[model samples]
Target chain A: MNSRLIIANIIRWLILLLFQILILRNMSFYNMATPFVYVLFLLLLPFGIPNILLYLIAFGTGLTLDSFYDTLGVHTSACVALAFVRILFISVTVRDGSDEPEPTLGNMGFKWFLLYAVLCIFSHHITLFFLETFRLTEINYTLLRCALSSILTLFVVILIEFVFYNRKVR
Target chain B: MRNLWIFISRYNAFFFFIIFFTAGIILTVRNNIYQRSVTFNSTNQVVGDVYKNLNVLKKYINLGAVNDSLAAENAKLKTEILSIKNIDTTKETVVKDSAGIPQYTYLPARVIKNSITNRNNFITINKGKADGLSAGMPVISPIKGVVGYIQDVSEHLATIRSLLHKETYISVSIKKNNAVGSLIWGEGNFDYRKAQIKDIPNHFKLSLKDTVITSGFSSFPQGVLVGTVSNTGISAGENFKTIEINLFNDFSTLQYVYVIKDKYAQEQKELEAKLTNEQ
Candidate 1:
């Protein structure tokens, strides 16, 4: 990526991280579902940004969140898992030699972006809640937390996507 | 050997993923102990400062609710003070002087960060070791209701494991009969407003809305309000009754709290340690 694009990405990462920890961290539905909008950073990272770089970035983002949430590596594990899911989903759906644009609602189209987001986010939430609870007896509640949080996160992500419709970045 | 090298090169990303994922798992496993050191949490210097500053802005929005709660507390304390003064201040003063420094001192602090949605919830406050606060200092909402105790302390911040957490248990007694039980979390932990009390003997009468207060056995000073008994059932153990209670503190809107400093905590701890060592 060009230096200008790199700077833009860094700024976006910081903004999303702050927004997630400061605002969304405090917003929970009946102490069950919390919208994790910070994952947008990983979801929209420039395509073909080397898998290693993507995972490392995801780990850092999750660690920052984990510090604020006092959740230790729970978010880190989930973020790394989400990074893997992101690469796998993109590879399966987007042809390897095809023109690559950043994954956003405007560029990827609604249907494709929705599928990509749901698949990736659910992977993150499921990993997060399951690792957090870490018990088989509470599987039902854990799954409920994952599903509710994933839906809330996806809704917020889409709402933000619509509000800030990005032009196709060259 | 060439094919093996090419295979490793091709899957280098997966190897990196495995390495980081393993580290994450290790951290998660050791997280309970990791919290002892205040490095990787909201109490960390940078994160604590951010929360402290952000609280300045958020406090404005919450002023109305804070006012209402404080007003109620004021009214209650007025009547309580009137009654205490009428009883015999001179005699109480004599007793208090003989007792040395007050057993528990209250250190006022602001709640910079709180969480209620997790199975294990923690609250971060702006007071820390510099203010003579330390781990195991009992924290309570104003008007002295049970909240939690300090779990870890840094220079200017401390994290409290709230009663809403799965592991938090406080010794409590029914006000009517003085029957003792342990207050614990879960049985709908998502409903942060509720907690469960177990080990009350089945023979004791437990009615709905019976007031529960701290029994002085635990770290808390005696008589701090816990909650009212909301439900009672047969505990798995034959002799014990499972009781549920409604917590008073709405952790969602919790802004300020008092961390209790016990003058006798260190001395008592040393005595207990010596007893264990003797055994």
Candidate 2:
């Protein structure tokens, strides 16, 4: 509703998009290392951000990336699932009524935050590579891509949060 | 009613995410329609420009290697020219030039990017519509030998169906014995190819290091070197002989290429089409 919040959302989303397209895309190590930084947008959203707006933003971001990659909907599916499950991850990790200001990676401690982020990202990537491969014959490759991408994405998310945000609140 | 509306609104995000994810999976399943999206949704102007810039940068980086290759090819060509300098004969064939040579002209190009790890690998070439290149042209790496053939064409850009593609079949032959075979890459990696010599009847003593050349049955001309025989065996359950060829081209580092464009391709395609229809 506020202009500041809208601008913040736009800036954050744009940063994620650029990171996905320009940086992660070129770092395809061994063809299986697909780093996905778009999930960072979901991870960094305000703690009580409305779910509907979150879904819309996540869908738009993922679809846009899929368009660029020439993959029809792998990113879309993964992004949506990531967005939906992201809240569940936050709730499980953060204690209730602890006066937690927000749940950025810096606030949550890198190790704990990384574990949570990796789980969510891994789920998204597994689903994505599975659908892309479309058969059990490529199970090994699909699994490798999912794991490698998750590790790289986790590192990118933590690094971005550390660089941009103050680490005083959790 | 108010509570129900509140509940719906609260869970709307979850429903939306599920819907969108399902929609994405559906799109993935309907790969044909999704593949069509490439024509509309892809930002050609932006992607094309970026690719062009990268191609230019790559060309600059590979200048030394490219120059060396051109020099080597030039020396070889000069030797051939000197050998046949005195011969003067002319005969017209389907794809022959005015001097009775092949109508095809080779346009040297650099591969901007190539994907071989994927099931359907495609190579991007630097030359395109502006370079007298059209679809269905065959691309070969002069230094490493046969690479692949052109598949899709765009302005100032083209996609090559690399030899690693499953559907790709190339007409090839044994250069030493003139035994004909079909060169195909039905497995992983560009280092290897499966050559099926079905036309060659059994009883020929095929051995290792027998040279494989383009059979000139397809778009590729005669004597374009393919590879040497790595292994030969009878099909476990079939009568035909299958030869495994170790491809000379190192696809992992394909920097330069020659796009072969036959001047008579259109006429030949039309005649072949008519003949096929008649049959």
Candidate 3:
């Protein structure tokens, strides 16, 4: 189980890295679009991974992307914040369970999984974009960019999970 | 000791969170310093090459407008040629043979990508070092109105600092009287540029529809048209004047442009440098 999870985490990082560098970097609609796909690595970590490790992974993933994009550390700060919030998001989605791991998806019904996935993705994207556009002078345009990128990110993350996640078991 | 070890193991994730978060914040704060580690900046040769390819894709979309502007410029040039031919040299005291030709050379180029909505807007053009293009050269639309100045240059691509830039200052003058003023850009809309005509005598009585032209102080020649005054007025206590001139060029649809290279620029700059040192 340990080897399987580690390998899955590596694969998830690889996929997210490629999606960010190759497909999303050039995507634009009137200068308000740049897809933030690196959040996928943080969003899909197994529930059992230690929160410290999760935060470290999230921050590192974000920094790696920032290094390439010349954007400094906006992604890193926001991704770490998102990773810290994931546990609360999971708990809120699965209130009845006491000892059971906070399920990212399978244990929850389809409706709950969709809700949980969207909220986590949205939280990460919104914070990440907002912090990136910290210069208040450009608030209106930055808000537009954040909102559009968040919606697109939500659609992309779910589509990726549906295609790649195991269907037979939780 | 047992309790301490248990606490350490239980909250390891929390400790990791602090470490990663700190690293992230430090990186964000020192971004410019950290940017040295980046190998793929927009100015990098590889990135420049990639954008050059993207220019090809953009050209297709702008072809129609580009062709129209070219046609218009061609018609104007033909008329100019005819007028020059009909001139009787005996009646005109010509200083030199080159007076008829523009002292500034033009390199025709295409705008690959341009943005005007942003406060700090820039334009990417298809011509660069291979085409003798360099930064500091003036870029103008085919209609001969000012557009922007080249800011960056690669082997085959260059970026222009748009006229919309807040800091852009160009020396200009009133076309009719040669009244000199510095042209300054406003924050948002680039369709207009304000000219501050300092020390204009209160007696001149400036009015609306006054024509503004490029001052000879720049590499741009004296008569290159800028715009006409939308309004003019005296400031609260200032003796000089301030005039708001509506620009002739529409930045939104800029396609074809001519990059002007002043033939005497190098010698002029060297003379100015010498004059400054002597003082």
Q: Which candidate has the highest lDDT of all?
A: 1
Off by over 4 Å in 2: A1-170, B1-42, B55-67, B88-102, B188-200, B235-237
Of candidates 3 and 1, the better by lDDT: 1
Clashing residue pairs in candidate 1, if any? Answer: none
lDDT of 1 by residue, B1-279 (tens): 999999987877777788888888778877845433433543456777888899988899999988987898899989988988798755665334364766778888999999988889999998888999989889999873889989999878889999888778899999999999898988654688888888899888778999999999989988998888888666565888778888777888899999888888899999899999988
| Alpha-carbon deviation at A54 in model 2, angstroms | 28
Candidate 1 chain B superposition, TM-score: 0.79
Task: Give the C-alpha interface root-mean-square deviation per candidate.
Answer: 3.9, 3.9, 4.2
Cα RMSD over interface residues, candidate 2 = 3.9
Quote the lDDT for A81 in model 1: 90
What lDDT tens digits, residue by residue, belong to model 3 across residues B1-279? 999989987766566667777777677766644333332343376665676687776778878977887898789999999987899977866544355755678898877778876677798888989998878888877774787789999778889987777766677888767777777676333443433334444445556888777887876766777888777755657666666777877777777778998877788989999999999
All candidates: DockQ: 0.24, 0.29, 0.27
The TM-score values for the models, in the order shown, are: 0.52, 0.49, 0.49
Best-to-worst lDDT order: 1, 2, 3
Model 2, range A40-155, lDDT digits (tens) per residue?
Answer: 77676766666777777777777898888878777788878888778677666666664544567666677877777887888778877776766576688789888887888777
Tell me the lDDT of candidate 2: 0.75
Backbone collision count in every prediction?
A: 0, 0, 1
